[model samples]
Target: MSAGPEIRTIFWDVGGVLLTNGWDIDQRGRVLTALGVDLAAYEAVHDEVNFFWERGLISARDFFERTVLETNPQLALTFEQLWKLVCDESKMLHPECFEMIAHLRRAGSYRLATLNNESKELNRHRIDSFHLRRFFDYFICSGYIHEMKPLPEIYRAAIDISGFAAETAIFIDDKAENCDAARSFGMIPIHFQSPAQLRVSLAQLGIAI
Candidate 1:
């Protein structure tokens, strides 16, 4: 049989692309301060908890409970409170980035989808609040998939659902490791820094801005 047809899909990572400046460094600092935890200590806790969460080894609630127990026992906070704190600290979507996605969607040249490492509740808010669901052909949330970025299974799932071949797909993400992971799967991975840079890079790839 002939080889599979070329992929013509674009998979975007939501946090850095659509939700610009959302996960700001200062916001993390603020979260730590509000929790009465040291920055280094909080980071260590976050790393550990996030590792388990990303690997699908634990539920978000469990991760939060364990994180608080190990990192900030002095605070005496519940999982719900911690969840609210983290959610509240994140910024909203940037208008320009939303416009960019709109442009890509309306251009009708590529199949667009979003793969985000976000909780189901938060993603629901994002989708509804921003009316983002209307723009993409598919939206995959890690919480629903129980798999997160840098994981081949999650990427494969997105590809399978989109019915797109690996080579024809272009994946955009802010993290180098995530981009590298997509490249390993034979996708054209674009490291996203800014909208202007993305325009230039996509133009180089013969994708209209």
Candidate 2:
């Protein structure tokens, strides 16, 4: 068997692979439930302009206005309050993932970055709260890039931003579809399941944690 290209760069997915999905409806529900707002109605509005919000075409305030405030003029919760509740939902799903990333970072063997679909508010909250900057060299998220996962552009952007060839890159995402897209884009892809399985997968790729 032939050896594959060396993995020089790693692109991580933030929401699922490393932390609790910032997109969980429950995250929204927490804030809405507090404000006596309807989750279904708010979610319907979110589904409509989510692309704009994630693509950096709209601000978080705008998203809240369109989704919450506009529909319910009497909404008692302030944007800041609602923001904090959803932000609270963003937690480290696997401490093992953090330890692994830290070890890899110390090894100085791979360039680290994140490729994810998230709005600016959610992305910033996780990055700040989790101190993710300690591991990742940069973040290639949809919030700033105006592109989302499962799209070829965001994957390419990660490679471009990392200044590495796609063949030398690996993308780790919890979504099989996103992993498939990364594979099609000429990068090694790992469909992350859990910390234990992830360790095994990384070992298979010659990356021992």
Candidate 3:
């Protein structure tokens, strides 16, 4: 069997793939535990407000006010405090993955871009704080586009924006569903497990980093 065409563009997912999941269950648990907040009460409405929150429809203050503070008024934590905790935890990025990106850029073999799901504030903070702009040609953020992953339109939008044919590009994400969506759009998909695993996968596609 022969390998596929040379991958011209590389699409990466931020959360879980490049960085830790923003405001995910583990981070939420740690933050809430430190704040002495009730996990059950917060989770009861997290699913309802999280989508809107991630889409930039609501501010961090508003999200916490409606979901956590309003539901559990006995909690003494303020919005700023809660926001700080979440932001701090969400900004953790894998250094090896970044090194890999830098190596890919040095090789000049592929155009790198990010297809990530994040809120406006969180996204802005993360990119700026991490200096992630140096690593990618473009960023396809769900908050900016009002679209999330595992959806077809976002993948289509990425392909259009990147100016690369779907067959000549590869999308790397930690989620199987997101990878499947990329495949459905005719882009190659890589289910990222670790930097080493990703290196092997990319090597198989003639993309060494």
lDDT of each: 0.75, 0.86, 0.85
- Predicted candidate 3 versus true structure: per-residue lDDT over 42-120, tens digit per residue: 8888989988888778887888898888776777778887788788896546788898899988888789999988888
Clashes (N, CA, C under 3 Å) per candidate: 1, 0, 0
- lDDT: which candidate is best? 2
TM-score order, best first, reads 2, 3, 1
Q: Write the per-residue lDDT of candidate 1 for residues 103-187, one digit (tens) a residue.
A: 8888887888888787666676667766777888888778677788888889888888888678888888999999999999988
RMSD of each: 4.1, 1.5, 1.7
Per-model TM-score on C-alpha atoms: 0.80, 0.95, 0.93
- Tens-digit lDDT track for model 2 on 76-95? 66778766766777878888
After TM-score superposition, the amount by which residue 142's alpha carbon in candidate 3 deviates from its true location, in angstroms, is 1.0
When summed lDDT is taken over every stretch of 10 residues in candidate 3, the lowest stretch is 1-10
- Candidate 2 wrong stretches, greater than 4 Å: none
